[model samples]
Target: MTVMRRTGWFTKSIAAAGLLLMAGQASAALWSITYPRPLSENDLRSEYPVALLTLALEKTGVKYSLLPSDRILLQGKALRQLKENREVNVVWSMTDAQREKDLLPIRIPIAKGLIGWRVFLTTKDQLKYFKAVSSTDQLMKMTPVQGEEWPDTKILQANGFNVYTVPEYPQAFSILQSGRARLFPRSVIEVLNELESDDLPADIVLEPKLALHYPTAMYFFVNKGNATLARLIETGLERALEDGSFDALFRSTYQETLDKLDLENRTVFELDNPSLPPATPVNTPDYWLRPTRQE
Candidate 1:
């Protein structure tokens, strides 16, 4: 009887230990992060919030893998894969209504607001044409390259402006430099960096007056189904913010880049006129626009 009782106790203990081991293995955190490609080494090394995010994840002892998609649009595919629980777990800075349906947005901002500066640049001959327009309404009559997905695009289009949507920043700059477009609307800091580079024409000058300003918050997105991982990332991000690690990372990576562009002296509010009514509120929840369902 004593032998039988001891055997029963040992069997139960073994089963319990096995269950605990399986649970621990299942709960082990592993994440995959997908980012947009054509990524330069400089981008990885110096870009502010993203670099900070990468560093913070590493510090947290979480196991993660990064996959770079060759084009911006392919990021959507990666996001969808995350939604389907296909091993992908995270994506950086994506903005599409369809993507929000399945992915949980980490409410914390990964970067500062999306700052856009609207300016009219012209050759010495056509300078007078832009000088006469005192307000955005008058400025809209001229040809401008509207950067796609930029919130400012809607504001311009609503005011009866003929906005030519371009695929990327380089193309928009090309249009402006080649005289295919008269005015180029872009992030002032980003454009200033390009202008200072060897690629831009020396004759072209950016106008002093900004036409519009847009301040938008950027976010990190995680798959809703992966609730445990999402919670861990969110908590980790908030901890980073509170501990000042994020600020340190931002200064180290982005400040030098800004200095090279001659933009270190500029404040975020100055680049994107903060007084503008359309600027998104800081820390607001992600506003996902839903698609209409067909009957």
Candidate 2:
């Protein structure tokens, strides 16, 4: 009886060890990635990326671990880290010629080209001024604000707009509030939430008349040499897109913001993005989101 009991106990121990080994191997397969910027109290900024990354990896059976929110680094520092092939493995950004040359871009617009449409955030007092403006040339006469290193700043300048740039994100709001910059361009997906945020200045209002359009699109980028990782992301994204998973994720994430924008009522002022790379697949209509045409 004692010998039988020992044999049973030994079998159970071996099974448990095998299960532990499998679990460890599974965990080891997950490639860790992170957002380049620190996560704020606002969940909107991080949620979209997390959802897309998760689904993309799952589609390809490529396991990944997104680092905790606290592990993020500033954009410039993150870019540097990617260049050096250090801790940070992946990032997402608006594409430009220089960035395409330096980083391996996944080339798929994660936001379905929606990131290219911008809405202005202006002080309540300045609202009346924009209400009278009817064209891009007229709008350019007024000062617009952007992040100091943002590709949008260069694009705006190339389009003949005088843009005020600040080093920090919050400073852009302060500058707008101070009337130092009359227009602060924000992604249409982001502007509504910014207005509702308790931390945002109460005096700023979304400009009602115009929506700025450009040729730019945001893409997932990695170290130029990390082609294997880039291929993994690209294949996953393509499969997700074909399976309707990508569209589902995008709509589920931004439906509220799209409904709120009432895009049909606003005039779109299309602008050129000179920095857009030759490799951008602009012909892919399936990858873009379009506003409903008004009757």
Candidate 3:
């Protein structure tokens, strides 16, 4: 009876040791995730998104090593790499029909819908022109410029605005300097940071009192078959939302942005995005930031 008891105890000890080893291995399996590298040293707009991604991963208790791609690839190239699962595993962009078809979206708006809230970057010469604009019709009279491949160009065109397709991104600002394009509509977060950079020509300024608003989501997308990571990030984001950490992070990062733009008092010109995926959670009242617009 004593030997039988000793054998049972040894078996239990061995099982416990194996369980510990498995747990240790699980903890050590680091998820090496790659994101797009910054285009320039002054490109600080990625700070909040990267920080938010870090916060979500921390909430999941998953050992992750978030790193940028080795090369500075454009948004289009980086997205292609993500689709191929080659250099990048993740990317954040506005959800449209084509993108939704190619990648698996986490379906959570990383920017809380601020991705669609646009504020114009104008030149001093166009200041008086915008100041008199009281409605979307009046605003559409001026030529608006956007990236050739950006969904905003289509949205603007569909809404009856004569939009110019910029040949290259860097030249978009120069277009404003040359007085060819009157407005370059940028997201509220993006415009603020770009204005802070010394690279912007002195003639550029933020247009006040008028904002172009739309309902859209910027979602993190992975390879179509990479459902595991999609689930992991979505789960982490949901957990953060449940505990209010997500709200905390957004408010802390963007409170100043709202204050600077004076969004509450601006007259909003709401537009429809024809390319938005039908699966977007635009109807989920709790999933977005519905700011109180003056219009």
The candidate that achieves the highest TM-score relative to the unseen native structure: 3
Comparing 1 with 2 on lDDT, the higher-scoring candidate is: 2
- Evaluated against the true structure, the overall lDDT of model 3 is 0.82
**Per-residue accuracy of model 2 over 1-295 as CA lDDT, tens digit each:** 0001125788989855754665465446867776565446663565687679878878766567777434556566666677788767788788888887778888888987888889889999988888778888889999999987788999999999989999877788899988999999889767877787777888888888688888878888889887766766776787898899999999988988988887777888889888888878888887788764734
- TM-scores of the models, in the given order? 0.61, 0.86, 0.88
Q: Residue 230, candidate 2: how far off, in angstroms?
A: 0.9
Worst 10 residues of 2 by lDDT: 1-10
- In candidate 1, stretches whose alpha carbon ends up further than 4 angstroms from where it belongs are 1-29, 39-46, 70-89, 94-103, 116-133, 148-152, 178-180, 196-205, 223-229, 253-295
lDDT of 1 by residue, 11-124 (tens): 989855754564465348566665555334433312544575676665556677766544543334555566775544566542333444556766555655433333455555
CA deviation > 4 Å runs, candidate 2: 1-28, 69-72, 292-295
After superposition, candidate 3 runs with Cα above 4 Å error: 1-28, 293-295
RMSD of 3: 9.5
User: What lDDT would each prediction earn against the true structure?
Assistant: 0.53, 0.79, 0.82
